[model samples]
Target: MDTRIRRGRRALVNWLERLHRLAPAKSVVWVPAGTFALILVLWIGTISRIQAEGREARQAAAGATSQVASSFAAHIDKTVHDADVAVRWIKYEYERSPSTFRLDTYKEKGLISAGTALQVTIVGPDGEVLQTTTPEAQPVNVSDRRHFLAHKSSPDIGLYISRPVLGRVSHHWTLQFTRRLNNPDGSFAGVVVVSEDPDFLTTGFNNLEALGVGGMLVVMSDNGYLLSRLASGEHASPVGPPASAYREMVDAKGEGFTDPVDRVPRIVTYRHSTQYPVAVLAGISEKVALAGYRHARDLYILMAGLLTVVLLAAAAIITATMTRLVAARARMQHLAETDALTGLPNRYLLTEILRRRIGRERPLDRLALLFVDLDNFKRINDALGHQTGDELLQNVARRLVRVAGNKSFVARVGGDEFVLVVEGMDVAVAARDMARSIIDTFELAFGLRGNSYVMRVSIGVAVYTAESETEYDLLRQADLAMYAAKEEGRSANASRYHTFAPDLAVRGMRDIERQQELQYAIQNNEFFLEYQPIVSLDTGDTLGVEALVRWRHPEKGIVLPGEFIPFAESTGFIIPIGELILEAACAQFSEWMESDPRPLYLSVNVSAAQLVHGDLIGVIRQCLERHSIDPRRLKLEITETAILKDAALIARRLKELRLLGVRVVLDDFGTGYSSLAHLTNLMVDGVKIDRSFTRGVPGDRTALAMFQSIVSLTHDLGLSLVVEGVETEQQVNWLRRFGHIEVQGFYFCRPVAPGSLQAGRAA
Candidate 1:
């Protein structure tokens, strides 16, 4: 037997030596074996880490939920205690003077406050509602109500809290705190109750972040009756009784369990109120609690799996695999830096380049950042389809790059905005030349979808002055300059490019300060209305008044419309400002109609922003209805520039207003490019010729002729005409020559405070 065993061992050793000699076989077996071993080790470690992390996450969640539950319990206990005190007070008052007791009188005397209870009621022993705090006390019987029966049957019951139920008197969901009221003989006389809205208990705690998604805050009685539940900041109805697992978790003070109803894992904690037979439960969704852990676990597992696959495959074609990985990384970097739509460097890459250039030991002597913004891009985009808009943006980018030349870098920063960096060889001059060239190129229409579309851009230039200027400051200055360019280009012949100046920075800061002040003004009612009467040339009597907004700045004394009107329009504060003016004007007009018994109308100037973005029609309707004023008494005066901006939208809105019986008119009529079109398309009831046209009126022959022609044309079109800025009697005389034309100017009355204006006359 020993000789046979020795022969077997010699045979095995020879076989192993032969196997080791085969290099390809060894490579095949060892590579997969090593991969398998690495994979097993990684998976084991990954699983262990994940399990430990999950446990830690659960423990943290349980601790947090327990804290929240404790807080909620304390809050509820205090709330119930206050309600019970109110109940006891009412019980004492009733037991002392049942006949003379009145909830209204107590409320009037400030003995009882509405904050503690939604309603207070007194129920006789027969369960008949005797008195209530509700304004309109209705007869109610609660013979079978749990709150009343619980208090009446047990005199020892100090304070019984009832589940949420519809109140017999208030007809709203409320929780009741009741106590038995006895006579002098110690017999059950009646029950005094303080009913509270369940929402009041949870409304004070608004930190919903503590309760993650699908989590809930619940207040339940000892018998497991849900009194109030809040989920996701909303009141929710009971889903049913708690499952056995949930009960067990509550009993343990805090634990993790799988909810049977939703089948979602949760970490739950509860606290029993020491003063009341109730508990507050705070449950956090385990999924949300361990979201970060799960994410890390998934990433690690995926990485490990990929590593294993790569290792196994890399043995063959190791060089090729490395080459492909390098190429893929390079491609990814490119993708990250490049804008997907315009194929230009994105904002990220632009920021990086700017920072690098600005942060160098020797900064570029002359670097310029040109911020280009497409004018009225949103309007055009909305007019044309998004597809066409995208195409247009792409074409614009190509043109910009072409105009910028190879020396400059052009990046599409965001939505219809591009940033061009010019350096070397007089960058400021180069920036100006590039901006002009780009503008000229855009002047020629671009063919999109077989249609020609002309687009314009506003360019702002900011040249680097010092190394102290940061990237953020540079960008902000450039952006401010761009807005300045846009504002300048509002006219037809103004320049579309502006250079950053010290004043521009000052203006930007002032604008921010003013915006905050304006917000405060709106909140504190610092704005008031001034009325200027519009007089009829024929009757020589005040016909209507134009509502003008005036800001009573606490510090500046008084800020005129011109000082902040344009800023308000730009910042979209004009919407709220306009609403206030409209409502005030309508209310004033309504009062005038009641006192004077004369037909009068009110005119409120509507900004272009208000016309374009505000709910003009709805505001008008609400004001008219609220003040009980006739819609015809309210006339909206929209500027011709506003109509020219979005003629179709403005016309539709005006038509809707007219249909509601409100009159519409055009202000600053002849200043816009499309005055005739506005008159015809807008269906306006009247036109107020701009103050500029009236400035040279009655004296300048040219102005008089133009005014005559406008009056004739307006009369021909059967539209009312109001000649504005009639400062002199001669102008009014000339206007009157046109046959009873309406006139408004300082000659009639300057704008005055609402109190200064009389019922039937100007101030």
Candidate 2:
């Protein structure tokens, strides 16, 4: 019947019905919904008991205190009124016979004794020799007294009550009630005083059980001057200081007031007598008033709660089997989207989360995806049992969660592979550092079973782009970078990470086609050579030509070496590819000598792979011998790094070629290894300055100084010099100032097909 319980139960039912939608359509109603409903009903029943008990406790306390106050005021008002009537009678006697009064006679007649006041007295106008109700009274004056001075001056001061004082006649602490006496012509006579002992109010208080053990009855002046306080069966001494609790309420001329008792927050019920100067305050114990009600209410609540729990238990037992079935289905659904080994989100959840992020993303809002794969994790699985490998994966997943925490979302998408998604502006800019932290998580060796295994991971990162890129595109880019890191062996030492670039995706697609068609291109003679003339800057005479290759893809027109050269080197296709260039260059040299001989030589590029794997010297000798060309006319241009790898082997090969009359020229000199490791260690005929340096010499002072230093170094070595990438007149002017040197670049002529270029001068 309680409205609160009904409302709370209705809300709980609505929420449970909505939760059923998340469960499968034809399955038994979501079993947790029943459990939730049971809990809500019990909770509402308990709250109803608390509210009802609290309201009854407050109302009972208030009603008890109000009844006590009314009884106290009625008793107090009669006492004060009797004192007032006796004082008025004493004044009439004084006026009937001035200067003489029989207060003793009145006491003997028992008129004052039957009154509320203890004694009555009369004072002279000179304020001396007061007639008090005592057979043998000692002389005493009350001129310095408050009640006496109040009545002596004001004719209508009415009845006045003084602060509690000990009387000279009665010899007890008393509150003085005084009234002014006036002559027949309205002149001041003296005052008639009556004493109220205050114990009279507590005459029947000990038998009133409703006051309880700690209840207080206080009678104080209207001005907050305390007269007396009867607490329990004892009275507070009249000599103590005055007290006030409801000073604000009492000072206002209201009929009566209540307040917190003694500032302890317990309520004081007060009522003022209508015909008297004093007010009555009765404070009943709140606990005493509500004691019986609370005991009965608590027992009822306890009994009801047990009943509710019994009903809830019966409902749970009826639905127990259904609940277990629903829980099993929910667990199965969770396992479907989770990795069993690592307990991390699987590929399905990863795809869902990434697509959801993209769907809600705003312009310029970026997301970084990092794909991490343990390098050579297969080796660990083969060495250790699957149980040990599974343990290791679990530990790694925990470490990833610890390192990234809530800053990024991490998921395990495959065996020994994890993905982390971090959202921010251009987060890929911080990709290297974030990636390094992930690698550092594996710094300590992982303990599995009884053995320790050290694992390292390679991370590839991709950042989102604003235009046309989907979630799948970012994932694919990150995967490509991961394989590149493993293939390039970049993660073996520093960085241990690779970031995706737009060109990497382009190269990735091109490599697929190139890897499939590369051998075909070499076998069908689809490769051909292009030559760029090497000329002298001052004389403008062509001294040599460099051989470059191109693939004329049937469908895509001519494909540059940049498109497939790195792919060839990685696949060892450059070895066969290099042979074609060497033979073509030697054959061209023979054609030059026969047509018009002027000691022209042909230079061919040697890749780092060819120098490492191929019989470079044998290939050159065979070409020279086959074309019937002199070895002097053949030159091999090698990069500085090509010799840095296996320097001993390349150096020995270079010597054999040199002895056979072939010249070795260092190509792209200023770009790599500025420390002269290759120049000093290996014998070379000349140095060719890289285009990056040649292009900057006319504008950048640092490039100019570097060019000057290389020129001085080669001249000091007594080696020949050739500068490439000389594209403008400014560059030509600068080189001419440094004296005569061989130069070749676009300023002279671009590379052309074999028969298109003359043997001597460019263009």
Candidate 3:
């Protein structure tokens, strides 16, 4: 026997065993048969009647849906034909007698007509009312409407219907139809607009009969504004633009078929006017459309109840008809096939569907399997407890059913993860915007146990096309897409079934290796120091040495700070690197001070990261005390641009460092954010003139003048200046001639080890 048959037999046996346990053998066997047979007969009759009613209900809903659709088409046909007639008549009269059919003449001739509470107005291209049949001469602008623009820009115009809008001129509802007016030379002279009240079209919406018990009829704009509804209660109060519920549907454009306006299942349909861009929507309640299905469902429930009674009676009759051993075996089989929760189809049933879908050779239409994972679901389970999380999942499942409607199938694959299979839709519809809408749906602040928490969903969409030849391939792509979404910061990301790019994979590997290398560098004391001597131009004496950092790599030897410093900064490892440089510089300075106590300062270049970090000052204080070095022997060199940011704060911080006897020098003085105004705003010991100006001064006249001016300004501001990159006697002389500027370059000596420096003046 098949598994389902065995399970059914086991379920019957289990019912018999329970009955035997409750009552004596004679009563259990005799009494239940009599009771169950009568109940079964009545239930069978009830189900037959219910099914007939269901079939009738379904027929009625289909007829009603068809009726509403037909009425809308009729309304569009009538409105466009009437508008075409009115606009063309005005054009004909104007062409016949341009002078006689002028504004006042047309009104006197009764050329314009009025209907009910609606009026018609004909305006020229310049916005002047040429003729009017309205109670008041309403000033109107036709330039903004597409109908008017179509007439204004083109000559081929009879009539054009514009999108519905709140008429600015009338302060009442109106639809505009424009007719083009042309000069004898075929140039656009003006346009004639016929304005009609909206009731001319809304009458169709007002007349739609009820589709079912819970049915409703509504007419809305392409932009989702509710123009009118057929429901009796003050439709106007809530009858305006669509709210959050219809937002996604409207954005999707025409024929946005979805479900449930405030949990009342609905069918939404839209049609765009062939004559114009205007859109009309018709919404029918799902309760009404599926009212027939409810009757079928009610009949099924009755059948189940009747079957339960019949089984009880049969079991009583067969109290010992089947052997005790067979009854026990059957009961065990039934338990294995059923799910404990939800009582819906199990994994086994789902596999059967997948197998059948894949076996067919027919061209499968576009199908998408979206694997949705709840964000922060684990956090909710951990914080609020699992019971609340379980309830939240159930609610999410219900919402998915509402959103997916009958167009898609949804299943709970595992904890907090749901699978949605939407068929016969374009794959692009499952992309980012739709994913965002799904997330927004869950973000509506879920209420649980008197506490509200926010929830979000990340969907990984896998579309089955000709590329996906197998079911496994489709499932794998969706799983990979889910992982991609999580890795890329987890709101939603979609991936297709393709190999990961080599370049991106290589980059990820390199990052991991680099992190490990950085960790090793930090652990081992591999960092060392190098000092470059700064020589005085006027006196030709060694002034100071700027401390530079070098790394003694395990494999590669002597790595420059420039090579590794950027990596360190990007990886946020610069804090430790800066500390190493500061400590080493201060200790080296202390040793040099003992040999030459005559206050020759040591300048250390500081990166922007080192200066901006909050703990830098404290690190500096700790290093100074540890080295037992005089603070005055240290001069901090920073760029002009670095100081320009929050100058007031930097100045205050620099003042404190200066008070501790440390000198501050501005490096790259001319390269960035350099201005005389900054010199006054910031308190610095000296400025290191950038090398560009010095390197070009001899060859370029502009460079020479700028260099000369900078030198003069440094003295005027009462600040000392260092001219860097001086390589020859001539360059040194040119810098000296500028007066009081100190120079440091190859003219004196190249940067050397601290011990290589000779303090004596040049002969």
Candidate number with the higher TM-score (1 or 3): 1
Which candidate should be chosen as best, given lDDT against the real structure?
1
**Judged by TM-score, which candidate is best?**
1
Q: What is the TM-score of each candidate against the true structure?
A: 0.55, 0.39, 0.37
For each candidate in the order shown, give its overall lDDT on alpha carbons: 0.79, 0.74, 0.63
Q: Which 10-residue window in model 3 sums to the lowest lDDT?
A: 493-502
Worst 10-residue stretch by lDDT in candidate 1? 18-27
Q: Among all windows of ten consecutive residues in candidate 2, which has the lowest summed lDDT?
A: 251-260
Candidate 1, position 198, lDDT: 78
lDDT of 1 by residue, 1-763 (tens): 2332234324423432433422331224455566678778878988898889878877888888888888888888888788888988888888998789888898888787777688888888899998888878788889799877787778898888887788879988888888998988989888888998877777766556778787867777775567777765567543445423246656645587765456667778878899889877787887888898889889888987787677767744554565576578669866987777777778886776677567663245478899999986777787787888887887777777766665565788899999987777688888888888878888888887777877768889998887788777888889999999998887663339999999999999999999999999999999998998888888777888899889999999899999998889889999999888888888888878777767777888988777679888788878888889888877888888777777777777788888999888899988887677767667789899989989987778887777888888899998878888988877777777788788888987888987787554432
Ranked candidates, highest TM-score first: 1, 2, 3
The candidates, ranked best first by lDDT, are 1, 2, 3
Give the poorly placed runs of model 2, Cα more than 4 Å off: 1-438, 441-481, 486-510, 644-649, 759-763
